[model samples]
Target chain A: MRHLASILLVLLLTIPSSPIFSQGRVLEKKQVALWFGIRDITRDSLANTGDLDFLNYLHSSDDMSEYQYLGVSAHLWFRGNWEADIKVAMYDDFAPNNLNIKAIWLPMKNLGFTAGIYTYPQLMNEFNMFHRLTDVGFFGDTDSNFRQRRVQESGLTAGLMIPFSYRWLHATAYINGGVSTLSPFTEKVTQKMINGNFKREIRYSTSHSPALFFFPEVELGADCFTFGNAMAGIRVRASWYTVNRSVDYGRVTYEWTYANPARNEVDNPAHHFSKFEFDAGFYLTW
Target chain B: MRISTDRTTRITVLISLAFLLKAVSSCIQPVFDFDFDFNKITVTNLDNSDVYVMRNDRDTMYSSAIAFEVTLSDEEFLAAGSLPKAETAFPGFTPATAMSPESLYHPRHHITALRIVTLEEMSPAIPAGSDVTGLFVAYVPRYSEGFLYIITDELLTMINRDFYPGEPSVSFQLFCNQDITASRVLFAITVTLSDESMLTAQTGIVNLLRAR
Candidate 1:
């Protein structure tokens, strides 16, 4: 999975060197640039979350987590106030974080509008492996031979962005809403064993995409060695998402018995969340 | 004009490459591997008593050769384990119903034929005519969306419903009638099961005129 993401990153990097944005080149209007950056992300769920936890059925592992700095690799392209970008985020042994590909149109000065498609991984494994606690003894790992991967939560996002410029200080305040495609899936797998043989599997899903999200953001810095074509900057962003419901997936487990349980018969509980995201980033663009 | 066309071509190529990369990445995890080991069938005609008798009214026949038992136990990667030990066989099995007749596309499994022949005839499925006779039976199971297959007769009877080669080991007798002639006859049974398992066994010449 890591190799797959790495290949995608390579393909995105190829865009800036492409000749499409080259011929009619001007410093501010027609230019090609690569923006690569390091980012740190932290999020808190804001909801009257229930006594239900999806972690009780997953295997234990010490090397997995929900957040990582610069976990998502993104690419942005711009031409005459119109831009297109894609971001694919993956972690937890390269399983999945989420993926977003969108376009932006700046119809007037200081303001821009955007729309795009996005997909998040199944929240069951996302919760268990990334967020759910696995070190809690028997609850963490039900079976050692068990493993699972959920595909995605996919949808469309629309938002507006307002940018302010003051010499070397820049800031963008943006808000967005998402509506998802109705997705439901099920999985069953058989495992071969030493002393015993049994079949195992997990699944079932439904999700609510974000309705609205925004937080103040600011960037500060200047052109260091390169004057017209290059600049370096640092940015701090805080974001909040309105309460949304996601029933991404439910308890994935081992041998329900020697007998294979009915597939897609189990349903996950609804998770309502208002999320918070804080990011600190450093970037170089030319 | 030339430069603009070059730029357009480059843009198209870049976009295509990006999508292609995305496609290749998301398709990494594989699901549902149907892995089952090839199996073998063990035939036992306990005690090698290979003879059958034809008596009018009095008792003249007591033979073990006429009955053969076929057993199929899964090959497990365990050292020493108790017999029928789940201690915990867990006692039940599930069968899946095929949308259509499994025989339409399913593999063949059953006792091909049980033939009785003279010493001069070959040991295979040579048909029985005025003098040569054999039992040929074949049926494809209706349900093979296989689930836990426990090797027990009671469960098998429910799941297979008259399917041949019913259990791990089932006994079958081979005798025509009381009015039959007495001669040395050889017994042969050819079987084929799931996972491409095949078994063909033939007993040596045995006296059928009277039980020894």
Candidate 2:
């Protein structure tokens, strides 16, 4: 993945001068046009309301926090009809464990249809240290100590992008099939008092192998306000559920893990993602 | 003027980027390592019953069993503690489950051995004297031994290794004589680690009433 990313970076730097997209309309004002689109999400990160079993399981931990992203987009100074575009999203707080980059081409301006390659890093919580945190009362002594390292299970994204921008407005429609990984939360234990001794009857733990978190979704982005080099608007994304069905993979069942037992398995009937979310944001270019 | 405006915009962008980088760096924290002790015990009441009844379930059967479940820590367990209803190690853990058994927490390194002493606290309201002393024996009942606690070494390590969930109760009942109409019996388990090294605990007196 590191080599692939390095190659992509080299390609991004050389794409503007490359013969492939070096063809475009010669502008009357300037022979070149270089603009950058920036979107900052750290200002606000509304939580992903305990939708997936994984997110809900993390709500009880002390290490839980909101993750942020700073997205950047660069449009090349290619001539008249052809242009090279690179979009990158850098994720928060950590050094640089997460990223989303897409390099696209627009054959022509207004009413243009484009294709792009997408890549993003994924994270997984194996939950190996959950028991230690839950059993902190053995000596009437409790410790607020808990921590876990996340595992990355990222995969590339494949999709079709239809971008249409007129005089003062811009919109893009996307139908993307992205791959991810999911390990539904699972653990079961029965406690008994044998001759006054508190003993545990551990019947289950999160032993099931993670299932693929692959889903197809439609996303639409539109910019309503456009000033000289910046545009502010809201984006909407619609997608089906993505949790692995109980029948397919064993259901995630437990107490003290979640509030509702009925929410043990939030699997969707149709093969889709467990998230049906709506994200509204901006696309500023300068 | 145009060049000046561009220069100012560039400066603002640089400052913003630097601040964002600072925030990200500050957020980076090393994973915490916790020192945890795993010695624990858990108790369960099968049917949530406070009173256990002697099951004749058969004509020749004079045997009985304790409804309460006392399990020692195997892999996951909460040790005996004085926790209020509002406070809990985990959710759904009530005071009934948090309170240690009779003398399970017998401070001062506890006892070298555990001895199960059975005695009748209350007897049925009758006119003549009733024999309630040796009605039943308090032992760690075993299915392999036809549900009877055979006299043997009562070491803390041995009890911890044996008593757990799904297995028969270490606090088991045997031969509830047909004569005893009603009585409150205390099957007390006494213990602490054989060697007062690190772990030490004493059993509390458990009150079980017999109902034919």
Candidate 3:
């Protein structure tokens, strides 16, 4: 998945650099720029499990609440105030954090409106294994095989971006929405085991649905000249999104006896979430 | 003027091509291939009293004693049996109306009723001209608790002449509530020949696991 996103970013970056877009206007000032930044992200949600103990085990050792990123942007100017721009960014965690390709029209120098495909970051939980607690002290330990469930948001996003400025301070706000597809689908999970020479399969009926989300973000910052035609700035952003109501995609387990059941069936719950994030970052553009 | 027109044409073609590629990729379908060859069936003839469960191989001997160890499900019985919903609701309660016409028309002792098990498959190897009119499944849940599930001649004919090489085996329905959770389920064939000779066969245990 990460590799696919990287390939897309590479394609977007190389397209404008080709002679295909240079048939008319040669090159203009500030048409190309590179940005490097460090960011601190504080994401919180009501439905999300904020339990540090659980998250501690899920995240890798290198994963942090803070990360760094680099980005490349290309702008193609057309009829006067009209422009087409594409920006792609990659984070230190090997995730493609941003990809926005849109047509920008600035009627006035201080304000511009844009619309495009915008990709961002999302968190998910993947269930990797399960075991039944039996009276014989967990029937068939270690030998039992593991089943995996990958949970993610995979889809196309269409939204709008608004950039405005007040004197030396610049602010950009974006609203994006999309529907999920093909990613962590909630479906039945089957676990098979061999007892003696015969094979037995126990299937768990699970359900999961595509996520519908609306993400809105606002960032404020000031740019100070670092070198000729190059500038650096620090910004603070507030971001929030709601992941719509998901279907009942939970796994159920049963307590069994060699004869008849001494007990009953048990149903396991699924995870659903929405989140809010605050990020402070410094970016150098040259 | 010509250069400007050429640039406009190039951009138009590029955008159209991009949309075409997106449409093609979006049509890609997910491939699903699962292994379905798993369950095994073995028959035990009454003639071979020492042999409990014999594999249905090509060289296997034909036996009048047809033993079938079948795992049944509550849903399958409720769906296949001629019993009413209100009657089957009572767990362990055997109903009188469970008999299908196939069982009632038996030439010998007419099978009064059917039980929980539903016959889904049969081996094609039964002797050509034997009277199978009085064959029915005798389902024994446990040592003393049992019931009779009659199998029609039409269903019996589907069985192979003998377990031929690569001969597809038959199967029975499994229910979620009744069969999977039941303490034990037993399925056997009791054949009363036209000459009054009787042969009975039983199957190996069918492992029925609960779904959901």
- Candidate maximizing TM-score: 1
Chain B alone, TM-score of each model? 0.33, 0.30, 0.23
Candidate 3 per-residue lDDT, tens place, A1-286, comes to 5676688667766755666555356433234446664434332323323111111112222234343567666556665777666666666665664665667667766566665555554333332222332212222222334433333344445566677778668787767677653233332222222221111123233343456767677767778557665567666666665654433323333222113212222222223344455555564433
TM-score of each: 0.43, 0.34, 0.40
i-RMSD per candidate, Å: 17.1, 13.0, 14.1
Q: Which rank order by TM-score, best down to worst?
A: 1, 3, 2
Kindly report which residue stretches of model 1 are placed more than 4 angstroms away from their true locations once superposed. Answer: A1-8, A23-65, A69-79, A85-98, A120-143, A146-151, A181-184, A188-228, A241-243, A246-269, A278-281, B1-147, B150-212
Over 4 Å off, model 3: A1-4, A11-79, A83-98, A107-113, A120-160, A178-188, A191-212, A232-238, A247-272, A277-286, B1-212
Ranking of candidates on DockQ, top first: 1, 2, 3
DockQ of 1: 0.02
Sum up the clashes in candidate 1: 5
Return the number of clashes found in candidate 2. 35
Q: Write the residue-wise lDDT of candidate 1 on B84-161 in tens digits.
A: 211222323312235322211111343333333334332244323223433211111234333222222222333322
* Residues B53-128, model 2: lDDT tens digits: 2322221211133333333332321322322223223322222335333212112222244333444333445222
Q: What is the C-alpha RMSD of each candidate to the true structure, in Å?
A: 24.4, 23.1, 23.5
